[model samples]
Target: MDILADIATTVLSQLQKPTLAFLLGGMMLAALGSKLEVPTPVYKFVVLLLLLKVGLGAGISIREADLVSLAVPAAAAALTGIAIVLLGSRSLARLRGVSPMDGMATVGLFGAVSASTLAAAMAMLDADGIAYEGFIGALYPFMDIAALVTAILMAKMAQARSRNVIPQNGAATMALGGTGSADNDGPSENRTLVRGILTDTLQSGAISALLLGIAIGVLGRPEAVYASFYEPLFRGLLSILMLVMGMEAWSRLSELRKVAHAYVLYGLSAPLVHGAIGFGLGMIAHQLTGFSAGGIVLLAVMAASSSDISGPPTMRGALPEANPSAYVGASTGLGTPVAILSIPLWIWLADLFIGL
Candidate 1:
């Protein structure tokens, strides 16, 4: 009875957040055909600030964490990201009859983490006075890059097998839906390709903020000054960001609706399935390492999120032949909202599993 009460309380409180309220408001206005808009630059700035603040805050907390404690969770988190991609890809391809390249793109998008979702999850944990491991944010890049690379490899292998050409240097001679080339561009091209992708991934505002925050947390003493600014201002920034996101999502509702019903199903189900799997895995990690309920919840949140900023561009660049609307619409349009909406449910699940 107490647990049920706690779940209800969590759900209500999460719904009442200013950030979530703004998100709903944005969606409502869009439905009403109001033309109010958040300037692109302004939205970008707020999102950047939000991510940086969260990352730095996490980093500060992470300094006291033992690497041994984080090792299993981090490894599990990365593997979970890969597993979700493989599952999403197979389901998209076999179930929906989507082409291999397009399925891989979907995998890439749904497999990676969403920075906004992470920020929102942390905010919820904080609001509820739940204590989570801050170093979980460090797993962000591992999961992000892992999903991208796996998707690329899957696409490469499928394309190669179709053409009966063994990939020489991997992803170098293989373009999506294009003939595999026998020419070895040598390792130089492969190295260059990896370098370029890394550069782009690292350049994302959220990622860069996380990385910078980690650096500061590890190397500097700005916690007192930084916390003063980040703690108080974080939710407000996230609120504005969510509002903009809601408006953007609402505007794209028509585009999302046009996606295949099968894909729509996949998008809706991916987060739920992945998040459940993630929570189960977190439970395993907890048994192994005695991690806190909040840390487990964070792991679950990481797995549940669908990528918004990082996954799409990589997919667009690699799988140009794929339908942009299908992947983008499915992930940003369906998956993200579902993940955000489901946070409370995950919290409840975490409690059941870990006794939070």
Candidate 2:
């Protein structure tokens, strides 16, 4: 009873926040076709600021954190993320009759983490006075990299398997050197592609901000760092960025109709499924690691959210056969809205799991 009441209050409090108000306002303006816009560079800067702030806060908290205890949850989060990617992609392909490449693309986008959703989760936690460990921010990269690799690999393997290699000449056939090495070569090229994709993901603005923030936070004293600009301006900047994100997400919603209903349904249901899995894993992790309920909640939300920022371009580059409209549309369109709306549900699930 208390849990439900607390969640109700928390939901109401979150709805009343200026940040969410800004988000809704941005969506409304976009809907009305208002010319107001945040410049591209400015928007990127805001995202960087929010990511770095979160990372730095996490780093400072790690000072007193137990490495072993943290490892348990981190490991669970990583495994759960990988499971989400594989299972989600396979299910989309099997259930939707989507081409293998397109399904992988969708999975890659949804399987990864969303920085905007992470910011929203942080905002929710603060509003609710939830206590979470600092190292939770570090889990984002692990999931991001894992999902990217899995998507690329799935695409490459499917492409290789689908090809019907035929020799046009006798000498050319002899040079073919059997299916073993040729098959080996495909996987090898995929590995190289995966490596390149990983490099790009790590070097992206979001990941870079997180890495830089962690470095600064780990080196400086927590009190001094929090008193500095990083702590003070984090939430306001996050809200503004989310407002822009909401506008961007709304713009993409029309693209949903460009694809099949299966993609749409998958996009809509992804957060709920992934969040439940994450929440379950987090509950098990709590028993093993004794991590805070807040960290568990963050982990669950992080797992639930899809990557709208880094996922599309990378997947398109790696899986050119896939329809860009389908992956990008489903992800930013149905998926983003579903993910944002699902934040409260994830928190409520966290409360149920953690007894908070």
Top-TM-score candidate index:
1
**Cα-lDDT of candidate 2:** 0.76
TM-score of model 1 (CA atoms): 0.89
For residue 38, model 2's alpha carbon misses the true position, in angstroms, by 1.2
TM-score of 2: 0.88
In the range 214-288, model 2's lDDT, one tens digit per residue, is 777778765675667877888888778878877887788788677778887888888888887888888888888
- Model 2: weakest 10-residue lDDT segment is 167-176
Give the per-residue lDDT digits (tens) of candidate 1, residues 21-118.
77778888888999888888897788778767766766776788888787888788878888988887668866654677777888787778988888
- RMSD each, Å: 3.1, 4.2
Clashes of 2: 0
